[model samples]
Target: MPDRVRPMRTVPRLGTYNGFGRTLLGRTKPDADGACFATHWFTLLLLPIRPLGRYYVKEGATVERSTGPGASTSTTEYVFLGEAELRASEVIRTYLFRWVVVPLVVAGPVTVFGLNSDAYSREHPLLFLLLLLGIPIGGIIVLAVALGLREKFLSSARVPEWVGSGPPRG
Candidate 1:
């Protein structure tokens, strides 16, 4: 009698490496809206995190030694959510903090910097310096805040639960 061997089968693996990858590659199941909202915003803010995690996580199966001869252990792994979720949450929180809180923190300094130039025109060259720096600093702060707000709104509007659900449960 001749020995026979079974053919091996392999499955293709896919993952995103950047923010866009998560938005594009993350599969939206009928009930996976929460995951999608998480994914979409994450993609906008931290595009690199999700896809990188996907790419780095093991997506294949391989054989290893088992207890007995002619026996092997093969393990197959799917994408990991630990790093992915953490990164996504951080991205969201960062945007939220940048947009919602940073302006208030910087506003007082900016206002005082601007006012210094009015009363001490002759006596304080440093006031002019502060005013000069303050304007640009305020502009940068505004830009950062704007970008954060835009990204947050865009991501937030894409809540998966609203758009992705299949149908009402009866």
Candidate 2:
């Protein structure tokens, strides 16, 4: 007897090339056609080190809600018709924006304000101490605020035009 309700297995298995495929980024919100851009990366220590490739595909998820110990519930997957295309710019921009740009944007002003706004005066050694303390604390506070706004920030991110001309995968 043939199997029924077969989940569409991805033909080109990602994350297996070079014995590593990790960090799928630049996944667009579902387009009008219900497909999105999915970019995978090669990672070291779970940090995306380089881009592997990208595909225009339909995203999939399997959610298992559980209240048990060590139980994980959500997983995301992508389905592409054919080979993934190398899209270096999109991947790099996404990576750099997350790791570099966001850091500078978030922390730069905090640091500036901490340094310029707070003076380390010799008359009050406490001021010096507070300056030192406040820099890190203020930075942490700003960082926390940025983290809190992460979902909103992510929601507003723009998705670039997919270079792949092929039909969107489902």
Q: Which pairs clash in the backbone of model 1?
A: 16-51, 17-51, 17-52, 18-47, 19-47, 19-48
Find the number of clashing residue pairs for candidate 1.
6
Give the distance in Å from residue 119's predicted Cα in candidate 2 to where it truly belongs. 8.2
Tens digits of lDDT, candidate 1, 51-148: 32211122335445585887654443443221222244445565555455555556656666667557665678777777767766776778677766
Once fitted onto the true fold, the runs of candidate 2 whose alpha carbons sit more than 4 angstroms away are 1-21, 44-46, 62-73, 107-170
lDDT of 2 by residue, 53-120 (tens): 56556667755577589764445566663334465666776778667765576566556755665444
Off by over 4 Å in 1: 1-92, 105-107, 130-170
Q: What is the lDDT of residue 117 in candidate 1?
A: 56
Instruction: Give the per-residue Cα lDDT of candidate 1 at 150.
Output: 68
